[model samples]
Target: MNDRWMQGPQFLYMKEEDWPYTSRENYHAISEVVSVIPTSKFESWGKLLRVTAYVCRYMDALRGIKRENLALSSEVFQRAERVLYRHIQAESLLSELEFAASLRKVAKKTAQCSSIILSMKPYLNENGVMRSMSRINNAKWLNIYTRHPVILPDNNRATRLLIRHYHDKFRHIVVNEIRKKYFIPKLRQLLIRVRKHCFRCKMNVAKATPPEMAILPEVRVSAFTPPFSYSTVDYGGPFDIVHGRKIEKRWICLFTCLVTRAIHIEIAYTCSTDSFILCYRNFLCRRGTVRKMFSDRGTNFIGAEKLLKTT
Candidate 1:
């Protein structure tokens, strides 16, 4: 490593290529921020910044300003949203939603009002924000914004972005918290759509994938074999059996035929190698010979097999 490299600045931000998914509204705000914020201070920092670093650093672009001059942290995001709304209006996109026909006592025939907005009783506030007219408009105890919540379009792209901004800023989408500021038509459906689109939330609520079936083993697939030809052995339980006055503990050594699905049970006195060997002999004597036996690697079963092989 070059020793002179240590002489450079401790921390620096390097700019990078354009972010494709960045909204046009935010892009304009980024431009607005870039115009006021000087790049000369970060001369040591590279010209192009990484995508992630850009997002992080953009938050603090106005950091060095004097206390009195510094804009509120929220103003940056609000400016972007305002720009977004302005762009929507210039395009005449939400014409039906812009004005409400039911606001006045007598409805005008020329007024173009959407059927969806009739029940909402929507009106424009002093700030020109579209808000719902509430019966509690006289309620001085609550905040004015709370009394008449901002009405948002259900299907607009801008509406989704605005909702995302609110959700990210506060981190909760609770009914009361959101109702204080905004209201949407069929809010339940809108929230569901938002949840579906969210990358992190969607991951947590993802649908479970069904496991694929495995290929059948040779013994199980062999249909022509007779009963006890290919046997699978397994222990059942240490069941209580009354012998005269005293009760004795015994295990059922279950032997099942793979081809015919016939089962043969043998009572073992204990779960030892000697007891298992005796059970195996009894099964063979009564049910004839077994060409192959499949079982889990239990200590008794393994020990019995080893002893039989050695003898």
Candidate 2:
């Protein structure tokens, strides 16, 4: 209802504290969008969950970064910004009007920064082929410092700090990761040669006294006698989301018979105790009663199991 709220940030990121209130709005928005737009609605729901996860992580990171006085866009900061933008869109933190206005500018700046860093990778081969800085051995510090001077201006303290950090992390190191990735074939060839040498030596050497082997005491193994022979009933069905005022197309709950491995399935209009009980009872009547059951600890399943046992 406040015009000032709309004008605060073009793409406002919501904190977890705001979730209770915003969820109502998000639910209504999703309903309106899903009813009219025939696009992949489930994808939108997945994005909502993803955004929530990202915001929670980012906010926590921001607290630490702010405390240390590090800039968000600094190369040395070492957090991926592309992921952040994706989170913003997924959470629907911004209204459609505000989102459309500011998305391009912020996204473009983040992408430009990434490109600048990506271009500074050192060329390892003499043939002008660009290789990772990690591939060159012996003089890694000198190689990176010389090749990526564009990223490290003498005057920029942040750039200087980044260069120092990079050196401290990896300078003078023979990068085993590069060797593992690119030199596996060479290692295989060397292994074959060594194996041949071992075989020849084994034939020439006199046989040494074999070490005495000792037999250990026998241990009894328990026979796996399961409490229940098998699940007499099994079923699988769709679960529609109905709580917290968010748009959800549907989810699935699968059931199985432990013993017989028989399956029953139904599509749920909404995932509720009633829906679960109806489907489960129908399955039992058709197949048979199960001796034991295994299901995800969802509320519906737990409640259904309790009610079923009572009857």
In candidate 1, what residue range of length 10 has the lowest lDDT sum? 43-52
Give candidate 2 regions above 4 Å deviation: 1-229, 232-253
**Can you tell me which runs of candidate 1 are displaced by over 4 Å?**
1-121, 124-130, 134-149, 153-182, 185-193, 199-205, 237-248
On the 0 to 100 scale, the lDDT of residue 194 in model 2 is: 35
What is the Cα-based lDDT of residue 291 in candidate 1? 87
What TM-score does prediction 1 earn? 0.48
Q: Candidate 2: RMSD over Cα atoms? A: 30.2
What's the lDDT for all of these models?
0.65, 0.41
lDDT of 2 by residue, 127-202 (tens): 2222234434565555442332211122222222322333334433323322332211233343333344454435
